[model samples]
Target: MKKDIILAGVGGQGILTIAAILGQAAIKRGWHLKQAEVHGMSQRGGDVQSHLRLSDQPIWSDLIPFGGADMILSVEPMEALRYLPYLGKEGWIIANRTPFENIAVYPDLEKIYGEITRQPNHVLIDADTIAKDVKANRAMNIVVLGAAIKHIGFSVEEISDAIRDIFNRKGEKVVEDNLRALQAGIEAK
Candidate 1:
């Protein structure tokens, strides 16, 4: 099996955390994984994106060619649209409905969402709210990651374990909170 994913969001939104979790999981599954990341002023709310490729066999490159991605999992609505050019015909877009408006004049949210809905395959989630509801407001990124878990070629248990491994150093409470955030995303509408 293979998955070519583009993960997008602004800095400080846990975009890299999501990538780390997925990368760890990929390793556990004994899959070939390659990644390329672009960080834009992450400390100051700049754009951050990563290309993650996973397959049973060796992957020749880390970058995903345009129109070749299997999924675009974005933590920001606009960021999701930014990577549309990389999505394949049947690729799915699992994106949060929230917007991290760092620009002086952000586009109309409704219009941005309109474009996202126009896609044939998509799952738009209010991950921020879901994370808050789970009492893990800081884990919103994990929530988005959880929402896209179904399309990630890994089971919830598998990803949960990866979460545990990644957050083990932080403490059990942190781990459990993140797991709750993950479940919240999975149960999101």
Candidate 2:
């Protein structure tokens, strides 16, 4: 089977890092993976999107066509709506409820939340609050990633192992904190 995922958010939210971890995890599972990223004005809180494709066969392209993604993992609720058109009818969406004001005019939280939940396949999580509770608010992206892990069909241990391996070079504490943040996010929902 093929899995196509799109991740979107503003800059400094670690969108690229999440994509990297997912790609690495797919690699670890011996799946052919291709990832493409667009970082338009990302440094200034502009839109950032990464496309990831994983399959048992080789992928010829790194891009995902409109409405072709099986899943969309958004670091912010507004951003999730922004990319909603790209999600397929059976797609699953995991989005954080943190409102991002810098990116387009911010919408009413309650209205947006209601609309997002109305979608057939959507999962909303308070990743920002969870991150704050874990004292790692900057790891919001990782938190969303953790929440989406189950839908991606990978074992949490495998993803955690990939995370540990990726951040091991940084330091023990950093790895530990990220793992904890990931676990907290995964368990939150």
Candidate 3:
């Protein structure tokens, strides 16, 4: 089996962290994976995207072809819409319901969210709020990842282990908070 995923979010939202967590989990599962990142002036809060491909078999390319993605997993709502063209007909969109409005020309939230929910395969959650509730506001990315865990190819324990491994350097408190955030996201309605 294989999965083509588009990971998107604005700068400073820790999009690469998500890729790292997932990539680590992929490694634990013995899956062949390729990740291609588009920084897009990330430090300036411009669009940041990563294309991740995982397969049980050897993969050929790092790039996910147009309309070939199995899912667009985003940490920001608008960033999710920006990659809609990459999603195939049966593709799923798992995005945070929260908006990260750094620009003056940001579109209306209702319209964007309305469009997101209109899709049958979309899973929208307030990851930021969920993380905040767990007192780990910075772990919104993990919360978002947790919410989409059911959709991704990896099992929950694999990703959870990756999370512990990734945040262990920050000390036990950080790891505990992030784990709480992840659980909150998994149980999010």
Clash count, one per candidate: 0, 0, 0
Ranking by TM-score: 1, 3, 2
- Tens digits of per-residue lDDT, candidate 2, 29-137, equal 8999989877546567677788999998989977998999999899988888888888998999899998878735677899989978988988899998998899876
Could you list the CA RMSD of all candidates, in the order they appear?
1.3, 1.5, 1.2
Which regions of candidate 3 deviate over 4 angstroms? Answer: 40-43
Better of 2 and 3 by TM-score: 3
CA lDDT, candidate 1, residue 99: 91
Q: What is the lDDT of candidate 1?
A: 0.91
Question: How does residue 138 of candidate 2 score in lDDT?
Answer: 70
TM-score of each: 0.96, 0.94, 0.95
Tell me, by lDDT, which candidate is best: 1
Native-referenced Cα lDDT, model 2: 0.86
Which candidate order results from sorting by lDDT in descending order? 1, 3, 2
> Which candidate has the top score in TM-score?
1
lDDT, model 2, position 189: 67
Clashing pairs in 1: none
* Candidate 1: 10-residue stretch with minimal lDDT: 38-47
Better of 1 and 2 by TM-score: 1
For model 1, residues 23-128, the per-residue Cα lDDT tens digits are 8899999998998876545557677789999899999988999999999999999999999999999999999999987799999999999999999999999998
